[model samples]
Target: MILTEEIKRIKSTEKEARKFGIQVGLVFMIITLILFISDKGNSHYFFIVGGVLIILGQLFPQLLIIPNKLWMSLGVVLGYFSSRIILFVLFYFILTPIGIAAKIFGKNFLEKKINIEKKSYWNIRNNHYNKSQTEKQF
Candidate 1:
């Protein structure tokens, strides 16, 4: 089946999300390294920032790749609270898995949806053919 605009959009967004995710991970790693090397006893603030960055890294990609509008909306709402470590972790765990699942299955899912739409349209058009044939038979 020909790729629909929506499917093309999703594929492109998924690529961008992957790149952004990699950048986030790298930045988080760098910050962690800086915190370790500095070894300041009062570095709790740095740790907090590192933790938040880690969650944001995961959350950002998940938000871009998630196919479900409801989940995407929920991700946005949850993102506001991701500075809280617990909610950050929760969002990372929940949304990341769903986003991965969407990536894996997205092409097939969209192809099926498109095929179904095409079939329905053709079925409607073919109904006229069937009726004309039957009407002439009698």
Candidate 2:
């Protein structure tokens, strides 16, 4: 029983982590799109708001696992700032390829290559239930 409960908790954590990642990616994209289309003067505001939204999206899903709201919020804030340099480096690695391609082939070509809106990131990986159901116990 204990092992089963632990497995369930682990699965839940994985689910939440996936959801949080998707949310952060979505918010980041939306904020980035708005910033890109808008004038340069409004970029500072978008950056601040985008940072806040990403942090909130990252931490909100963990609220159920974390009991103390204050500590959770504090942790989120500290995590963002403390790891920012590392995160920026990671971000560059993750996004730089796409950025370079966009510059070369143009943004529209890149968009046509990977259209997130039509692809629907959240709906793409829905094999979990089917796979679990199909698994047999010996």
Best by TM-score: 1
**What ranges in model 1 sit over 4 Å off?**
1-12, 41-60, 64-138
* Candidate with maximal lDDT: 2
**TM-score of each model, paired residue for residue:** 0.26, 0.25
lDDT of 2 by residue, 48-118 (tens): 66565455546665543332333345555666567887888777987887778878976664234666567
Error of 1 at 12 (Å): 6.8
Report model 1's TM-score to 2 decimal places. Answer: 0.26
Error of 1 at 71 (Å): 20
lDDT of each: 0.55, 0.57
lDDT of 1 by residue, 39-132 (tens): 8454556556556544554666555355333334455556545647777787799977877888897744343455443535343343444666
Every candidate's CA RMSD: 20.6, 22.9
